[model samples]
Target chain A: MNIRGLSLETIPPIFTPFRFFLSAPLSGILAAILLIYSGTDIWLTRWNINNLALTHLLTIGFMLIVMLGALYQFIPVMTGQLIPGSKKLASSIHIMISLGVLTLVTGFLSHSRIFFILALFFLGIGLCLFAGSLLPLLIARLQNQLIVFLLRILYLVLMVTLGLGLYMLLAHAVPSLEIDFRNYTDLHVLWGLAGWIVLIIMAISSQVIPMFYVTPEFSRNYLKMLSLAILITLVSLSLYQGGYIKALEVLLTLELLIFVVYTLHLIGQRKRKIADVTIYFFRLSLVSLLVGIIIWWLGRYLAQQTFYFLLAIVMIYGLAISAITGMLHKIAAFLIFLHLQKLSLSRPTAISLVPNMKQVISSQNSWIQFMLFLLSYAFILVSVFFPQLTVLAGVFMLLSFSWLAYCLFQAIRRYQKIQLEILALPEMKMSI
Target chain B: MAREIILDVSELEPPQPFEEVLKQLRKLQAGEYIKMLHRKQPLPLIQLLHENGYAVSMSNSPSGLWEIIIWKMSDPVSAADCNTQFGTNIIQADVSSNR
Candidate 1:
């Protein structure tokens, strides 16, 4: 149990978390771009097998892939332990997951059962490999209360979602399986969104937000209670979808209230009082989340198609994308800083190793993206009922996401350049 | 007259632990200065000290060891000082520096 002596070559403890950092936001960007191009006019009509393909493109391609990578990186840091798997195993899992997402999306779009089955097999295998690789690290470092709890819940939700996904895919191929795809799909989305993604984000944010911004620590009791409440609501809603609607509504409202209060508290207490673009992004995201909840609640009561579309746009494009974009700016800068700091320690060179955080992501471009996203989101909300303005919103969304993707690419390129510079240092020649 | 307090932190576990040493040094001798020799970048620790009220000067030795010189501040006492002053487990002062 000598954590310090763990070979750095065996997938740097941070590598897994870094993977999530890269994959998650990029997945959102990709999904947004795809949806924009496909035209916003199409309503739930888009929720067919083809749209399922698009869904996986976001969920599996973007969400799970990023989550897996994050788990790899963050788990070790949290537990003060390293993953037991080799780098090759991690690479294989990445490849399999990527291929599986592509294949699954294509299968859903083409209505090809063979490809559908193949997609399930590949994705399932990839997930299993990932889980297997991470299990030891998770088990070994069960002492870290916050991280261990988050990791365990994340893995459980992932397993349930993946199992349900596989079952649904198989049922599509062979209808005699007696499994209800609709129920399973709904449960999968709930678990994936609420149970896995949100829980982990909350857990990590409780630690990182204070550390990064030099804010006071959040109340541990409040955080623990919120986590449990969210988990219980998600499980209850899954089991009793119809009966638990009122309860779910109350719980969701409570959760959002807690989040808003906590986020505002953190921002208010932040030591760095400078105007940060990332903080602005977070503000926009919180607003979007509020709008989304209102839309969902309205949709349930009014039965309006407009409310439904607005809810989707707010949640998927608005809150999700905004938070992701904001995080990418920080994560990219932080990783580069970490890598350079490691190098600077090893090699005492006069090289200006640290890249200014502001330089990593263009504030102007991010603000532009934020404005465009908001505009497009508003237009889409209007177009859902009007229908004629759909093409205009679609165009705006296309431009906004494209610009976001470009910004991300530039940031990554800058990071890569820094990496190359560090690698080129004569005294610090070690494989990354 | 300028006096140099040498701290051989070759055996220091990590940056955080090393900072504990800095804190103790700051407390034991208020006016005397420090020139830390360590095999790792002590910039973070230096920055921490600076933020906490100590004025620091940093340089690199020819043999790749980092040298950080910290000077005590000549100012009114602050709240952070009270905490650090009374904090018993802040640093392992018993672990004698090899220098």
Candidate 2:
């Protein structure tokens, strides 16, 4: 077992994580609105200005936002390592990143050098502040555990990816910088998506699947070696030429295939066969990842430009976003209940008013939200082929994120209201 | 001999595990302490127990699961007996007050 920081105390206050979670979906909602506004033009090619904006909206806004929030919560709770100056530091990180994403999206859509400069500024501070605070702690954590090890890799990847992104943005910001925007942009995307995002997801899911769901543990050595294998392939992709690149791509795909198959195997072995909404999200994410891999293979073999765009859509909206949305539902509900339970520990008489996880966010409501997200996924997949269906896809996407926002809002409201009740108790009044 | 309340929540998910532990605690008698088997250390539950004047001692079982012993501090002997019975070190927590 990966015993590292179980003895450490101090999970950050609930709002520390929730602030990131609540705002992350707004980017998804904005991306959908952009699609509704642009319609067919947004589906034309990945290079289209509005399409680039939409991609950032999902990537930085939705995926990275949720991840930063998770790391804020996870590093402390799982590793038993507390973040120093977390409240002020966390708030600053959130604001900078939220502005970074908005300005980045605006920069993409407007093709303005000034907005690009602003994005570069905001994202730079936000990402640096994040890495500055956590990277040292993660590196210093003394364990041969896979999570700590993989988190180190994740931080390094983020730094390198940020370096590549800086170069790309500088070319736009300064206009005369000696940078091959097209060639290097591909490297930035590869490092950001495949290296940074994919590896972190792999590391976390390996830990939580068994820990939370009563499934068999993923082999620690296997995952560690796989992390190295992916790093090797991504490094090889950046260095190699035409013929060798195809082989490298195959190596990465094989790694993903193993992940999908093994995850499905683990899910099948779950002691409790009753599936939750989070399980469905994972299954959907797995299938979408497989679908993305297939699309890439077909697009490469057939030399069809359209399939590449389809591949991008599947990976971003279908795989990453779907998983994150499901994660928000599960984590937010639990934290609300857990923190409320903490409140009642002080005011023992108010214990009954602190609802269980199910009461906080009903299974039926979450399942319905998951269904909406799946429909949004389908409409988006279809829209890639039929450009006219773009607006309809956008509408469904908006509804899914809006409802996610509502669900989160209600859960937080419950937390606040119950908090007020606990403070108002007769015992509380007398103690005061 | 102190009575034992065996709780094996190795398969239950979150909030359910917390609820089950609390429910089981309410049913305890003066001479009993819970011998709870869990997959991971239930740290939050342990904290709550100590705050409410319950004592806890935990160590890994042969089954590779955590075996946590919880009792009222007034009944420390039962918790100590459990440590001896399970061949675990006695690592008691007594916060006694939340405020």
Candidate 3:
């Protein structure tokens, strides 16, 4: 009832999130390039260096970067709390993370022991700083709030994921370390994918889908228990990985099935009947989630390595990437539009008119980007079956990301141009 | 006398308030004004109204309900030309609520 989050007067500076948003697509383009040049051989086994490099490039480089930015931007919106830091801290965090991701990918591809160690150092410091920035705000308001509690858990799991990853890299680089990397592999991957990524998505979806899409709110009874359910599932799944209880896997799968179904139902009930590209992205993401889980479930009976690899691909690329892409397009455009609107209010009679969100980032451009992404996704799915199609998939990925980058860049450019035009007016000083 | 269109969009989730407000704005007559009750300021809605030559003044109550009255520029009783005290009260109320 306070409608505190809706009040934007105290939110962080625009560049804080915008810098991350702008950098994300470049990482996507890099991932596509890695896929193309690494060739079909890289697609055969998920354990290959190229495969590992490409996955991180997409997951850490693109998805995590965007999520980090969104967290910085939306946490304030969600909690009605200010992010603790100056604008300088935000920029530094962005730089550290970007550098960390770049170095980590380079280490994976080059097989340099020092690079791997440097990767750990950079990534560890950056992630810790990032988490520290949000921890205070989250800690202050976590009482009796399910979604924020889930987000807090997500951050905890992310730290665990990063720790396990560093240890794995350490073991690999120094065989004398005597760490069992294999023992931690599945746990590391699941905690990162299911714990951090999916949990954050669930938290955001619960708030956003209803708010943005004008859908019936998700069942309060079910949602209230979701964070606890997910936490229990993750803990149980970790124990199950250590051969403690087989039944936990079933519980985890059941939780996911319920989540996917509930999300689909909410999407179905959305009242807005418009040709929204963001909605299409959400549909693609939700469907991919279902498909990924089914593939994961089949791995118990099939026992095929390819199925496991395919499951990872479908989950990370198909599900996670698709979901974030939808979020990125919507959030980026909305923030720009919101800021421009607020700025324009100062000079009421200015000759320059502020552009609406749709006008700034045209629906037609987004649709084209979506179509390219869809085609690329289909090709990637096909490539999983016929490895020879990986290059074609790579090409499509390149085109899709290039188009995406172009659209985002164009929107940013438009925002800046309008800002400059508005500022040029002598009346702007009066409004501020 | 033109009647006021009262829209209580506080119960309706986000963007629905946004969408509904925009829709109602289209149907607004020259002499008519809308008294919209919402939980939030609905900044985007306010912006669109501004762009379309409408004037809006909103006040937030201590109970957290926001009352937004919007009228076209040409309207006799538009916020722009209303009793200065009415506008002053809304602004003072908004400031006090924030405090």
Candidate 4:
């Protein structure tokens, strides 16, 4: 593949990704509201209707939304080709998935067959549309790179997970399906979380952490081999469930351990050391993974729901959310800075001052959000045991997401105001 | 005599390299050229330069630095002449008419 063909010319408009990013925090806020409304029942078990609703809200509504947006922007950087019809495709997918997730959440909370049917139609169609647009791009131009290999595996796993999810939804919608729901749920969750979510994070970091931070590049040889190792372990785990391949499981644990250590080392080695909030988010994610992995490993011996609950909390709120938040900070600032620089070039006299990354989105604002995020995370952790503290956690979560949405909305507004100023210039009539 | 501006961009991250190079390009004059050294080829920057009546010759040297020597459309010292100075991957895009 001619990777160079994937340049800025091929990149979609900034608004394509921004739309998805702006919607993400609202979903987080919704999840928090669901938690608050569910009250004590949410703590009963992972299978609790409210618990399922909250998890889907975070997983589908927040993380997947952010990931899709990131991919629309990053794919050009990676592959030198844009997904075809990016803006329209993104807008349509966003609408379908957003509404689909809402319906799915309602289905879970109310246990209504009609809601389940609507969710099945919406989410299944929305996700499949995303896959339909994305898969061909990867297959045609992504070549044999390690990221591509892993992405292929990730996409396949996502499809399987989605398929199982639809099957379960159908089973709920139609009672005579005779499908084994319990066992399938285990596979679906594992594939969705571990296979797709965790693996994509690890793979993207192998490139991003180095390039974005000016840190040491991850060992190329290890990176080259890691995709296959992760794929094999996932497949093995799928087959074994909790049985043989103890060695494979051990290897998976080792891989995660290396991630924690490497992230710490990378942060220490960063070229610009005057504290950034994104670094804190990265550290939070890595530490959460370490803690989550340890709790999960220990769960093998304890066989208790508390360990699993803590693990889920750390995974969803701590690791996944933190990672997305960190990446979002950088991506948002970079894209804004880029477009501003472009405008500066196009209308040099009209736009004399282009904002730098920090000016676009202040570090202080991000820190405020980060602190709120941490407070909410702490509350959620405590609520895992206390159950009643969920209300407090929910309140903090609402504040955190509201702050994030406001910051992003303000940045985009700033971008637009500058754009209008540039366009209003009499000299800018012909050039750009 | 031709004027040469050298920018060392190896330590910077991402679009900074792209941005700094463009900022410098705005100051370019007739018979002047820029020599930018970065860790990776600034592909978008190269595209921008091509469209703005500038030509670029990029090389990944044995020392692991990308040297992009850029000159005006009228410059007699072509990107081909600079290709012999570096080790691998020479990219020369001439779009002076588009300017």
Q: Between candidates 1 and 4, which one is better according to lDDT?
A: 4
Residue pairs that clash (backbone atoms under 3 angstroms), model 4? A6-A80, A6-A81
Q: Please provide TM-scores, in order, for all candidate models, with all chains considered together.
A: 0.73, 0.91, 0.83, 0.91
- Pick out the ten consecutive residues of candidate 1 chain A with the lowest summed lDDT: A1-10
Judging by DockQ against the true structure, name the best candidate: 4
lDDT of each: 0.60, 0.78, 0.73, 0.76
Q: Would you list the rank order by TM-score, best first?
A: 2, 4, 3, 1
What is the DockQ score of candidate 3, to 2 decimals?
A: 0.13
Better of 3 and 4 by lDDT: 4
lDDT by residue (A184-263, candidate 3, tens digit) is: 98888988877777776787787778667767767756865766687778877776546555577677778888888999
CAPRI class assigned to model 3: incorrect
Top candidate by TM-score: 2
Report the Cα interface RMSD of each model, rounded to 1 decimal. 15.0, 6.7, 7.6, 6.2
Model 4 chain B: weakest 10-residue lDDT segment is: B90-99
* B1-99: candidate 2 lDDT, tens digit per residue: 778888998888776888788777766776787888888776666656665667667777788888887777666667567656753444444233111
Candidate 1 ranges with C-alpha deviation above 4 Å: A1-33, A44-46, A141-143, A176-178, A241-245, A418-432, B1-99
Ranking by DockQ: 4, 2, 3, 1
Chain A (candidate 3) TM-score to true chain A:
0.93
